[model samples]
Target: MLDLTKLAREMQGISQHLSQEAVASRQRLELAQQHLKKAYECQQEVMERQEKWRDRILFANATPLEPLNTRIDIPVPPKVHTVIATDGSQIAPNHHEIAYCYLLNIGRVVLHYGQNRYPLMDSLPEVFYRPEDLYMSRQWGIKTEEWMSYRRTASEATVLAELVREVGTGDGGLGTGRRKTGDLGSREENNNQSLIPHPQSPIPALAMVDGSLIYWFLEQLPVDARDRILPPILEAWSQMRAAQIPLMGYLSASRNVEGVNFLRLLACPHPAPDCVSYCPNQLEKVPCKVFEPLRDTALWTTQLTPGQRGPLWRSNNRILELYADQTIYFCHVHVGTEIARIEVPAWVAENTAMFDQALGLMLAQVQKGCGYPVAIAEAHNQAVVRGGDRTRFFCVVRETND
Candidate 1:
């Protein structure tokens, strides 16, 4: 029950504020584009450019994009593939309820595409009501929403990794075919393969995470929670890696500026040694300032065609500092009018065959959902806890306690 009259008036005021900001943002975007044009025209010492003004300039310090691959329009080859996607939703603890409790729900969908379309889905909800679960520590305070978010992410990673491990081991009742290298060739081929310790084999399946592989929420966790949560996630990741499961994190509507940052590197006016410790006065002359408000997608919108993917760029997040082994590289994919960012680990990113398959499957999934990954969309649909269900859940808890 909101006060409709007051709400309408407040919305009107908020809309006006947004309108003004939108106007300013457009002006800034235009200026940024102008600077980008000039910088591209004078693309000298591009690799040597430094991120000196990263702090002073908003959206600065972006690594200039180096296109490892050109715009590719590989059609989605007709293949029977297995795609598993997982998504999670959480309900923060409500103090008004009978017990201090929170709920985490995870939804997963496994789809087999080809002659017979079979979809297997599952939803799991874990309710936390114990005193130990309600609070982080007696001395610290109650478990904050951030703690709950970390739990949710860890749960997501666990589910994804476990699914990958199961699929990798040729279990989980999935309809994927595990093709051994020896099946295709003769004794000489067998001799060639048997000589190597670990031969390159195509993974039978792909595991799709609903978000980025890098856990940003880890940056905010308390020491205790941080220590407790990361192990399971990393172990699961290790299992997936050992099994050679190809995993991709898909962001349907990404607002990433990695491309923009890359453009900034290209725009650095001063050459190397001087640019690294560039002063404010010299920074003012840098060209990338023109594209401040524009995200990587904005630049790639016109640059890529439908189903075409842009180059891979390394992420610069501090969280990535520890994950160099699983270094993150993202590519911009043209999904109709929308641009999607697909992030993959170093194993998948560096492997040409795996990269192409991931990209193609992603494109096929996007087409299925019109603009987004259909597997993720379906998983979300299954995972979402409706408002009515939440109200009823709390009501049932209260009645049971009574």
Candidate 2:
């Protein structure tokens, strides 16, 4: 329990500490703004040399296809378009439960606009009790939160892939589209119009997930666990790419600093940043530490209008080497309320029509939902498994078995 009386007494001291830090916070912001201005000035050289910095400087720098200061207005979305989204939730195996089992629930949503197409929203739940499902290796410990999260993401991607096939190409899903009722409702197929290279009125749609598309966390997992998680997500991305369906992962009010780290690469004082040799020995303040306090949102919100997006910045993480051809990219967009980070793959960023449509539809969805993507908002409503629900789920397992 919290001590409210003690907390009240400590409030003054907390305020004093915050007051002391205010000046320092402003100083860091000013320095970051100045460095961002310099970065924009030398933006061409930065992107030109950004590749070499990946090995030379050991920070998460980004490679951009446009100047950091460049902002594009969100395209006016087509009145007739569709947004398909998928999200997942899970209950890890608990020792306190009657049965040691985990549950994964995938929420699927499809909202078609302008035309008279009925929206579809559904949740699919699966339970796993097998040893193979709970353990990645014979030597591994209990399934951790990080482990289950990746599994949930894979499940979401797999569902999104199915939705894309049914919606984008009119081809039947890869047989993984199982709902509570085991049906993926019939989709209206338009074989005459292909999505690649911007089909004329051919499925103006975006497939979305709740978080980042990059599986960079694979770097932290053991080789065995990595193999289990990465391939499924990659396979899902591949399915979407082959269909040319523009996909995005909407991160609201993202505090990501990838752009700032790239700015650090440009601001490196040393002629060539030999990270291993220089970083370990540096006792003084790192030259680029000035920009560390700011996120991409802080820099772009001031420069962009509502429904405008910043330049596409390719992730420079070496873990992306495992990503093969599906290079991950991100950009900042102000969706009328706050600056958000939207992540996509290389193919989507390269195609102007697909890129604009995705962003435009994203902005439209956010506006329709009032500051959040509607499909994601609804999908979350479907995917979330509350504590009460978990209790009942385990209760059912206990009752049915006993």
Candidate 3:
């Protein structure tokens, strides 16, 4: 454990530094707020010149698709809409272990709020030990921990896509009439009740995941591994899009400064942005220093009302250039508890109706869970592999091997 007694002096020093920074932070925020006001006054010009900045900044920042200050009210969610979500957890492989194995546990959830559908909740735990799984991992020259996370991402997407296809094909098993118990605790069959989709009238649903859709980590691997791993995930996404499902990734209490960074670009005093010359780190000492202490969510909270959502912006990243149709777009919305960041693919962002409804449904979900999305929270509950479970898993493997 940690010796708090020994850390007292260090803690005091840290506190003193924070107190000094607090004064500096306020000055940065004030200058940023001023620049934001100027941008709002000339919003049209700002939008027009957005394309030019991409060439100058040469870094990832959110480019507003519409007016910077525009806010859309959350449309009231439909009385009968379904929210389907999937989340994942993993047991990373340790080299010291006899079995150098990793496990991925995916939680699948279907919460039907309409007339005839019952919710379905289940977890899928997949353990990899096959030569192909290990062989491809070793080829990347990365740690098993890093490699396992990539696998988990692919697995989670595949699982969500599979469920979306199931719902699309009318095999979701959500049926009419309530089952004797609430939701299925495990994968047991509810033979007593009639299934959810009648195959005639399918329910409208929204698909969600608990984290980012961007597979940035996959870029670190070799071309062979990237080709091997990313295609299946892209294909899974393709399936969801082909089925016309509205999929999203929900990030709560996000401190992402992509929006603020865009402000930095706007606030840059350069006729031509020569970052290496004038400003490098965007520090208080630099030319583009106004937004240094600000965050996207914090800035948005000051602007967005309880029911309003900020504009969707196409996020810039080199990895996204290859995504083609899967390029990411994100928005900040006041979800009562905090200003939450919501990310979606290019198609959803392009479709006006889908975008509004997506926000509304997410807001409804947040209200249900008080501060977070209920489907994601429940999915996390199902997916999490606690310390006890991890210990027992090794014990079981040891016994089986003996």
Candidate 4:
């Protein structure tokens, strides 16, 4: 009986050891699988990099040839004007918070009511465009903030519709329509009819948003939303034409998927000259005339030596520093005979590359004089709020005299 007991104890010990060994083997297999996954991921990254290089080469070789320019000078009409409006907003990540700032330009017409002054035509024609309506939240994170902020602040389609309705019916306190009477009418009736005048020629107004948010908003819109917005845009176009308005444009500026800033120029077909073009470089020369005087007096005063300023001026390094430091700098640039000194934040300098690309693209397009109305918008990360958390997308409209 003692020997049998000894044998049973030995078998039990051996079984326990084998169980532990099996668990260890399973762990080893799992570790091997993880290593293989890492290797596969690395290989994928390499393949992607090689494919991108090949694509770049193909694109570089396929540059499109420029079109021939036909020289023509047409007489411009008197009282022909263009209206431009710009607005910006911020979107935060995973929240419902948003902020907005907007500016409207009604060509030469300026109207004042109480303490507020508005352009003759408001960009957000509907009451929905009120600044107080702007808010911030973070439910959707960064992506949601961007989309919602843009949806509310960057779309001019609603505003344009309101303008058309106002002009067409003369209903928004403008008192436009007049009554007419036949000769058979009595003297009092004739007098009343004479007091009414013909409808004035509608002023061409171009509502401009700062980015491609307008397009994006339109694209993501549901079928019902599209049905609601499209009619108003078209109606506005028709009213302007009926009133003999030459042309109207909507400009959007945005960044490409690569984060490069660009302007989306669009317009209704009209007799006005319009075109789209781009410059390879626009911010090459610093607006030194605007900055030199201020730099000497305020930025690089006697406290800072010329040697220090020298490094700052080298290839926008100083500008970048100022922006990173968030300091205010004065720029001096020549506008006509007088030197214009402009105060700008250092952040503008840090973002010079993006601004340059956007400005260059717009200037090139405006220079073309193609006779079609155009709108331009810009998209990129801009430091809008005081704190770093307020960073958001901005859009602007570009207006050209030509």
Candidate 5:
């Protein structure tokens, strides 16, 4: 009853199927290997090209660029002296989420204050970037669309106009451009359109906007808006004489050693000896040495009190609490021979009371035996304090001016 020929045919059919599957698998494996090889080759080539570019940029001993002479030299006008310090904060719906940006512009005036901080002028012309305009599409990865209505509101413009009117007004009355005319004899007559100059006030209307948003808005503004807004600011600066009040700007940096090393590598051609053979596993054994005399130079060092000594020595927790106001304190050790220009923050400059109580105490120690005109720079320069809370304070001191 056993059919040997049929059984032989079935076994041969199974062997053929297995052979076909094995060939298919071999083809797939070869394709994967080829793709991996191509990727590795591309990555290696890119790395080599980047290294060459880096060497060319870093190694070249380029001379410092001369200051540009394109700055506009407007004549200084005679007017009343006033210091208008304007700070703008871009606040979102929720305080928990990160803000787009915050900017502070402080304009100082040496005018006599009769009643209050500078006599109560009718109004002050304050220019600020609208919060609604600060809805940055780049943050949310959205593109600005042409079809969308991209114009500022009438109310917003009115608010700015009112501010200007108040600031420009004096004992005589509100400055020109305060009223709307009616149609007379079926024709609208241009009557009170005149540039009435403020006699007592020569202090240019100081307007500090939040970040670079003002520049963007300027590009989109109508010719009329641009004319109205810019004049006051330019006049204010002209009156103040750009040299008098120190105009401050902010730049940020990384706190970690790796970040500092990368910056040094970018700035100069000299490769760090320890960084040449960097290994994550050998980090513990290798004693980390600060390279680049200019950047690596520690400006100030505060000795940890007996109570805070243990935590102060730890790597990340090196910062010690100095004052009761909760300002974080850390000892900075300056080792370089050359004097470094340090950048300070706005809060330290504006809030003399807090600076005296908290920062002044710490800086007092460093100022001892040091020459006068010693600059005490703040560490995180770009950070802007929006709210009244003094708890959220962070500071860092950089060795270089840039």
Candidate 6:
């Protein structure tokens, strides 16, 4: 074993240095606290005054904002419901290895909640050896890891869509509602009112993904390559929407500050007829500049209670812009004192019943796993490639090839 004396001394010195830096940082924050408070006040004031001219901000297409102070307590899920989640892991290509290739694995878990929680697990691992997979294409100019990541996300979506379709259209799925001794329209009205299923009614199911529906990295590719890569994702999304399966992207310990950016937009002190072009330098000014460093989770931490979720805020990114009509919305949620960021598409957000049901199931999943979603946790567990497994995998491949 190595001697600890020298290592201990070095660690002590580093710890002391970190402590001094922390003290200095706290002092700096204290100095800026007043400016941040003033910036927040300005943001609230501007939002109040621009109620009628709200479209001005939307037209600018910078950061979008909903009401920031609203919070809703998600309801508990039904006794008998199903949640399906998918996650992916990758082993990137290593130049030192004999083969110039990459590996991707998608793991899926379906949990049925009833008298007892039953889980179904599945995984698909793919190896890429094509010329396009091993080298950067002249057309796209993207590395293998980047393109493979998008492909994996598309694969996850495809799997989720297929699962949802199977459940929704299968026997005793959502399509088969309980027809009581009444007219068809009356039965439809009754089915709409009830959150739980009737004896013969189709069971409700939700399909979840570990990340956002819109793959933002697709922006890195050229138009032609982007078109080629986008059809699978779009088709999967379309299928999910048509199937009425609420798809959620859950991010634990998310550090996104999109909400803070929106507040900064509102706090801009410039008096321009058009905020985007004319007020370019407004953010560098006093109040807006103060909030530039704060994120939504940090700013709203004190406002949210356990199990509470905030109002939806629209995304202003280019990918969301590409699908402006079918935009994505997100909100912060407090799960057992740990905050998480959740994203859903416009189709789920617009339907109140569906949104409530989806959020309820998510909350239940988190409760079951303390602070994280159980379905996602199991999927990750199945997808992860441990160090020993990775070594053995390469060794086996080499042996087979030799």
Model-by-model lDDT, in order?
Answer: 0.66, 0.76, 0.76, 0.28, 0.27, 0.66
Q: Give the TM-score of candidate 2.
A: 0.88
Candidate 1 per-residue C-alpha lDDT over 1-402 given as tens digits, one digit per residue, 9 for 90 to 100: 889999999999999999998888778666556655655555444444344444444432334344333577746644867788889887777888887788888776777665253365766677777766666543344245666667777776666665565555544423222322111111111111111121134434677888788777666656666666766666656666787667889986777776666556655464533444564454464554555557767767756888788766667676666664776777888888588888887778778777788788888888888878888988888888899879977988899889
Candidate 3: segments with Cα more than 4 A from true spot: 1-17, 47-50, 95-98, 173-196, 276-285
CA lDDT of 10 in candidate 3? 91
By TM-score, the best candidate is 2
What are the per-model C-alpha RMSD values against the true structure? 9.4, 5.3, 5.4, 25.6, 24.2, 9.0
Ranking by TM-score: 2, 3, 6, 1, 4, 5
Candidate with better lDDT, 1 vs 5 = 1
Of the two candidates 1 and 4, the one with more favorable TM-score, higher being better, is 1
| Whole-model alpha-carbon lDDT for candidate 3 | 0.76
Preferred candidate (TM-score higher): 2 or 5: 2
- Candidate 2 lDDT, 177-235, residue by residue in tens: 33331211222222232222323456677898888877667777787777777777788
Pairs with steric clashes in candidate 2 = none
Question: How many pairs in model 3 have backbone atoms within 3 A of each other, for residues 3 or more apart or on separate chains, i.e. clashes?
Answer: 3
Tens-place lDDT per residue, model 6, 23-106, is 765554453444445544564565454443444443222232545556789788788888878788888877777777777777
Cα lDDT tens digits, model 5, 84-168, are 2222212222233233222221111112212133322222122123343334433433322210112211212222233333444
Task: Answer with 4 or 5, whichever has the higher lDDT.
Answer: 4
lDDT digits (tens) for residues 1-402 of candidate 4: 469988999999999999997776556444433432343345344333323433221111110011101111112222333333333333332223232333221111111112122324212111122322323213223243343444433233333333334434433212212212111111111111111232465433333333221133444545444444344434433443453322222222211111000000101122211221122233443211112112122221222231111111111112222223333322222221222222222333335442233222222224322311133321111212333333322221111111
Candidates 1 and 2 compared by TM-score, better number: 2
Q: Any idea how many clashes model 4 has? A: 46
Model 1's C-alpha root-mean-square deviation from the true structure amounts to 9.4
